[model samples]
Target: MKRIFDISMSLIALVVFCLPLLVVAVLVKLTSKGPALYWSDRIGKNNEIFRMPKFRTMRIDTPAVATHLLGDPDQFLTPIGHFLRKSSLDEIPQLWSILKGDMSIVGPRPALFNQDDLVKLRTEVGVHALTPGLTGWAQINGRDELPIPVKVDFDAYYLQNRSFLLDLKIILMTVYNVVRSKGVSH
Candidate 1:
């Protein structure tokens, strides 16, 4: 049932946002030196590694680390990068991940491949059994602001309480957070 919901919703999203996605792609290309889509090595379900695409919000020269870990993340931003991040437009390409079965519409957001501590903690708590997502409980709750352990705790909670209705609620809350630009530090 969850898989069906993810596929259906992701397909609809890809169709409805098609033109806007094109526009964003062009914007990213024009504002940055790298490809419009950035393929990141992200940790997925059961600790599997997968290539996840996001609209490139940072420059090609930017270090391959979490944005929060960068000493001066703003310095690496392409001209429109900050705007893309703030608006959450950079995440549009992740619909493809959902379509490809590497991600769900609602689950724990994937961790960067090098985030060992996060992976370990989530694994210890059995939160890594579920697939990663474009938006999740941690995202709507605090997003970039939450600490790793707390994020894993939220993931565990979602794993335990997952349901169609919970996913719907998370999706709606994600919409609200994205619209308000709340809780996103980067």
Candidate 2:
């Protein structure tokens, strides 16, 4: 049922928001000097790895590893990157992943494949067994502000208590956060 919802929402969004996405792609390309889409490795369901795509907000030189793992991650983002990050618009392309069943609309946000501590902690807490998501409990709760352990706790909570109603609540909270321009750390 959740998969159905994710797919349907993704398709509707892709169709209804096509022009906006194209505009974003053009903006990203004009504002930066790279491909409009960025594809990177991320940990997925059953602890497998998959390529996750997003609109390129950061420069092509960003470390292949996790953003938080870098010494000064913010220095790598383009001018439009901040806006994309704040608006969460850069993540729109992950709808493709949902369509491919590599991700769901609401689940624990996927971690970069190279984030050793995060990966280890997720495994230790058993937060890594499920499919990843574009928006999630951790995203609405605090996004980059929360500690990884706290995020893991939230992921574990969601894992144990997931339901369609909870997902709806998270989606609502996400929209609220996006509207208020709150809780985004980067």
Candidate 3:
């Protein structure tokens, strides 16, 4: 049921956002030296690694580490990167990952492949069994503001309480949070 919903919603969203996606892609290319889409190695369900595509928000020369880990991450931003990150426009390409079955529309957000602490904590709490999401409880709750342990706790809560209704709630709240651009520190 969840997979079916993911596919259906992803397909619909792709159709609805196709033009914006193209515009963003073109804008990214115009402003950055690298490809518009950045294929990041992310941890997915059961601790497996998958390539997740995001609109490239950082420059090609940026170190391949979590933005929070970077010293003065702003230095790596392409001209429009801050806007893309804050507006969450950089996430639009992940719909393709949803279509490809690497991600869900709602679940715990995927961790960077090198985020060993996050992966280990999630695995120990059994949250790694669930597929990663484009948005989730942790996202709406605090997003980039939450500490790793708090984020993992929210992921574990979703692991225990996930349902169609809960997903719907999360999706709605995600839209609200995105519109407000809340909790995104970087």
Question: How much lDDT does each candidate structure score?
Answer: 0.93, 0.89, 0.95
TM agreement with the true structure for every prediction: 0.98, 0.95, 0.99
User: What lDDT score goes with residue 173 in model 3?
Assistant: 96
lDDT of 1 by residue, 13-97 (tens): 9999999999999988887787999999999999999999999999898899999999989999989988889999899999999
* Predicted structure 3: lDDT: 0.95
Model 2, which residues run further than 4 Å from truth? none
Deviation in angstroms for 146 in model 2? 0.9
Clashes of 3: 0
Model 2, residue 34: C-alpha shift (Å): 1.3
lDDT sort, best first: 3, 1, 2
lDDT of each residue in 37-105, candidate 3, tens digit only: 999999999999999999999999999999999999999999999999999999999999999999999
Clash numbers, per candidate? 0, 0, 0
